[model samples]
Target: MSIERVEIAASPCPNDVFILSGLILNKVLTSFEYSFKFADIETLNELALKKAFPVIKVSFALYPEVYPDYQILSCGSALGFGVGPLLVSRKEIKELNFADFKVGIPGRYTTAYFLFKFFYPKEIQKIFLPYYEIIPALLRGDIDLGVLIHEGRFVYAKYGLFLVQDLGTYWEEKVNAPLPLGGFLVKRDFPEDKKNRILQDLRRSLKYAWAKKDEVYPLLKKYAQEPSQEVIFNHIQTYVNSYTLKLEGEALKGIKVFFETLNFKEDPENFIWENKDGIS
Candidate 1:
C-alpha cells in the first residue's frame, strides 16, 4: 500500500525548525507520511483560515478566526516564561504617542500584534510587514517602532535597537502565567485516531531533536535567520518546553485568559484535542 501523504506547514524559525527537523528529515519513526511547507506565520495564518493544510503552526492570536475549523494539538506549541515579542525603536524615545508614532507589526494575526493591541488598546498606525522585514524598515526609518518576534527577539540589541517593552513579560506579569505564542493546528474534521497518532509522532519528533541536538543543528541552521549557532540554540531553548510536549496546568490557563481577554466567548478547553491513548 502507498503511504498517505499529509500536508504540514510551519515557520522556518529556529525553534520550529529544531522541533520539526526530525519529522522533516524522517529521523522520527511514524507510520504517517508528512510533506512540509515553509512560510512566515502570517501567511500560514491566512492559509490556515482556508483549511489549506490539515496540520499547520499558527499564532495563538489567530486561533479565534480558525477555531471553528481547526483544533489545536497538545504538542508542538511555542509557550514559556520570558518568551514574548519585543517592541523596539532605533533610539531612545521618551514619549510614546500612538497618533504621532507609526508601528510596524509582523502580522496583524500574530500574538505579537495581539499583545500590542491588548496593551496599547489605542488605534495606532500599524504597517504590516514580514517578520524579517520589520527590523530593516525600522533601521531605514520606515516605521517609528517595530514589534519583533522569532529570532528578532534575540538579536535586536545588536542592531542598536532599544527595547521599549517586552510583551511576553507584560503578559506573564498580568496573567500570572507563561504566554502561549503559537501551536500546531489540525483540521477539526480530521479523524481523531489519526490526529492522536500524529500528535504522538510530533512528541516523538521533539524528543528526537532534543536528544540529537547536534545532529539536527545543521538542519536548524539551514533555515535560521541568524547564522550564529548560539542564537539558534537559544531560540530553541527558549520556546520548546514541557508545554510543547503537552498542554496542561498554567499553560492551558494562560491560553484561556488570553482568549477571554479578547472577548472570545467559547470555552478554550473545547479547542484543545485530548488524546485518549495517553499521548497528551
Candidate 2:
C-alpha cells in the first residue's frame, strides 16, 4: 500500500518558516500520511480545530482555547513568547490611557484583539483591520493606535512610531504567565506510534534549524514579503524561538490567565491537550 500523507498549514512568514522550513528544505518527511500546506495565522486557526492535519500542523497558538485541540511545542524563546501586542501610533502620542482611546487590532477575532478587549475594556474606541493595513491607516490618521503583528513589530520603530502599551507586560503583571506566543503543533488524532515518531522528528528538526540558523534566513526571505534583508532578518529573529524545547511554567500561567479573563469562556480542563502518554 502507498504511504499516507500529512499536510502542514503554516503561517507564511520568515519567523514561522523557522519551525517548518527544515522539513521542507531538508525533506526529512515523517513516516505518516503526510504533505504540507501553508496558511496565514487566520486561516491556520480555522483549519486547525477541524482536526485536519493529524500528523502535524504548523501554526500560531494565540488563545488558550486552542491548546486542548492540539499537542503544541516550543518555538525557542520564552520571554518573547509574550512579546506583547505593540501599540504603535504614527503621531507623537506617548501614553495610552484606556479611558478614551481608539486602538486598532487585527481582525478583532485575533487573540491579541480579544486581549485588548480584556485589558482596555474601558477604551472608547476600537478598530480591526487586516494587519498589513493598520500601519498605513495609522500613517493616514485613520486610527489612533495600531496593534501590529507580522513585520510591523520589526519596522515600526524605524518609522518613528511610539509604543503606548506593552500588552505582554500587562499580561505578566496581571497573571505572571509567560505570554502564550505562537509555535508548532501536531494534531491529537494521530496514532500514538506515528505521533511519537513525528514528535521526535520535530525535535530533531528544531535542533537542526537552530544549529543552522545562518543557512535558514535566505530561505524565508521570500515568505516574509520584506524586500529589505535587515527587516526580514529581524522579523525572523524576533518571531522564531529555538523550538527545541518545551514551554515553561511562567508562560503557561500567562496563557491560562489569558483564557480565564476572556469572556468567550471555555472549559478549563480542555485547556491542556492530552497526549498518547496520558499526560497533558
Candidate 3:
C-alpha cells in the first residue's frame, strides 16, 4: 500500500514551529507522509487564497473569504489575550493623525491589519510589508508607524520604538474575549478520515512539544525569526495556551465576536472541524 503524502504550510513563528515540531521532526507517528513549508503569516494567507496547500495556517481575519474552500481545524491556533499585534512608532505621539502618517501593515489579509482597521477605520497612507520587515522599516523612517506581530511583539521595545497601540488589548476591552489571530485550516474537500487523522496527530504533536521542551527548543530555534531562548520561550507561552490545545468556550466566543464585528455572515460552527465521535 502506498502511503499518502500531505502538504502543510505555516508560519515560522515560535508558536507554530513549537506546535508542529513533533510532526516536522517525525516525533509523532502518523500513517501519511507529511511535507512542511514555513513562511510568514501573510505569505501563508496569500498561498491559502490560491489553495496551494492541503493544510495551511492562516490569519483568522481572512477566514470569511476562504470559507467553503477551507475549514478551521480545532487544534493549533495563535489566539489569546495579550497576544494581539502592536502598533509601534519611532516617537511618542499623544494622538494619532491617521491621514498625516504613513502606516505600515503586515499584510492586508492579516488579523493585525483587520484589527487596526476595525479600531482606527480611517483612510491613511498604508504600506504593506512582510511582518518581519515592518519594524526595521519603521526605524529607518521608511514608514511612520508599523503594526508588529509574531516575535516582533516581544522585541519592539528594544528597538527604541514606542507603543502606539496594543491592538489585542483594544480588542479584548471591546469584545471582552481573547483575540483570534490565526489558526490551522484544512481544505474542505479533503477526505474526512484524513482530516481527522491530521487533527489527531496535530494534537499529539503539540503535546509532544510540551512534554519535551528541551528536545523541541532546537527545532523552534531552527525556524524562528527571533531565536533568543527568552523570546522563543515567551512566544510559546503567550500564543500556545489552552486555546492552542483546543478551541472552545472563550476561544469559540472570541472568534464569533470577531466575525460579527467584521459583519461576516457565515456561522463559525459550519466551518470548524469537530471529530464525529465527539473526541477532541
Candidate 4:
C-alpha cells in the first residue's frame, strides 16, 4: 500500500526535538508518514503565514494571523508555570529607560514579543534575530536587550548576561495562570478523519518518548542546539508537561485570555480542534 504523508515544521530546540523525537526517529508507530522541516520559531511562523505546511509549530501570538488557515492541536504545546521568555542584558539594568535602547526580540509574531509588549507597552526600537544568535549578537553589542527562548533559557548566565526580568513570572503575577507559549497547528482544511489520525499520532508519539526516554535521549542529542546532556534534559523537563498531554483547565483558560486581549477574529472555542461533544 502507498504511504500516507503529512508535512510538519517545528523549531530545532531541545524541547521540540525531545517531544517529536519518537516520531522523527520512527520509534512510535503510526499509519501515516510524516516529513519534517525544521527551522527557528520565527521562520516557522513566517512560513505558516503562507500555509506552507500541513502541520506546524507557531507562537501563540501568531495564531490570530494564521487562524483562517490553521486550527490548534491540543497536544504538543510549550506551556507551563515559570516558563516564559527572559529579557537579558550585558549590563545590569537599574532605573533604565527601555525606549532609549534597542531591544532584540525573537520575532514580532512570537509570544515572547507579545509578552514583552504587554509588560513594556512602549514602542521600543526592536531587533529580531534567530533564537540561537541572540546571545552572540548581545555579546557584540548589537542590541541592548534580547528576549531569550528555547535552550537560550538554560545558558544565558554563563555568557555573563544579567536577567532584567523573568517574563513568565511577570505574566503569572498579572494573569494568575501559566503562560501559554506555542503549540502545534494543523491546517483547518484537513479532512476530519485525517485530523483525528494526526492527533492520535501526536499523542502516541509523546507517549512513546515519555515511556522510553532513554531511547529518545540519543535522538535528542542528535538534534540539540547545545551538546550538554544536562541542558537537553533541562529543556525537555521544563517545557513538556501535563499541558502537553492535552490542553484543558488553566491551559485552555490562558489561551482564551490571550485571544480576547488581542481582539482576535475567532473565539477560542472555534479556533481549537473540536469533537462532536466539544473541544477535544
Per candidate, the number of residue pairs that clash is: 0, 17, 0, 0
Where model 3 places Cα greater than 4 Å from the true spot, the runs are 278-280
Which ranges in model 4 have alpha carbons more than 4 Å from their true place? 274-280
- Per-residue lDDT tens digits for candidate 1, residues 1-280, read 9988888899999888877888998988886898999999999999998889999999999999998899999998999899999999987978766687889999988999999986688878899999999999999999989999999999999988999989999888988988989999988898889889888888888999989999999898899889799998889889998888889998988888888887876876679986887763
lDDT string for model 2 (125-194, tens) is 7776766777888878888788877777767887778777776677667775666555556665556665
Error of 3 at 202 (Å): 0.4
Worst 10 residues of 2 by lDDT: 271-280
Candidate 1: what lDDT?
A: 0.89
**Could you estimate the TM-score for every candidate?**
0.97, 0.79, 0.97, 0.95
- Give the range of the ten consecutive residues with the poorest summed lDDT in model 3: 271-280
Could you arrange the candidates by lDDT from highest to lowest? 3, 1, 4, 2
- TM-score preference between candidates 2 and 4, better one: 4
The lDDT of model 4 is: 0.86
Choose 2 or 4, whichever is better by lDDT: 4
Each prediction's whole-model lDDT (CA): 0.89, 0.60, 0.90, 0.86
lDDT tens per residue, model 3, 48-128: 999999999999999988997999999999888999999989888898786789999999999999989977998989999
Candidate 3 clashes between residue pairs 3 or more apart in a chain or in different chains: none
TM-score of the candidate numbered 1?
0.97
Cα RMSD to native, each candidate?
1.2, 4.0, 1.1, 1.8
The segments of candidate 2 whose C-alpha lies over 4 angstroms from its true place after superposition are 27-29, 49-69, 73-82, 94-102, 242-244, 263-280
Candidate 4 to truth, TM: 0.95
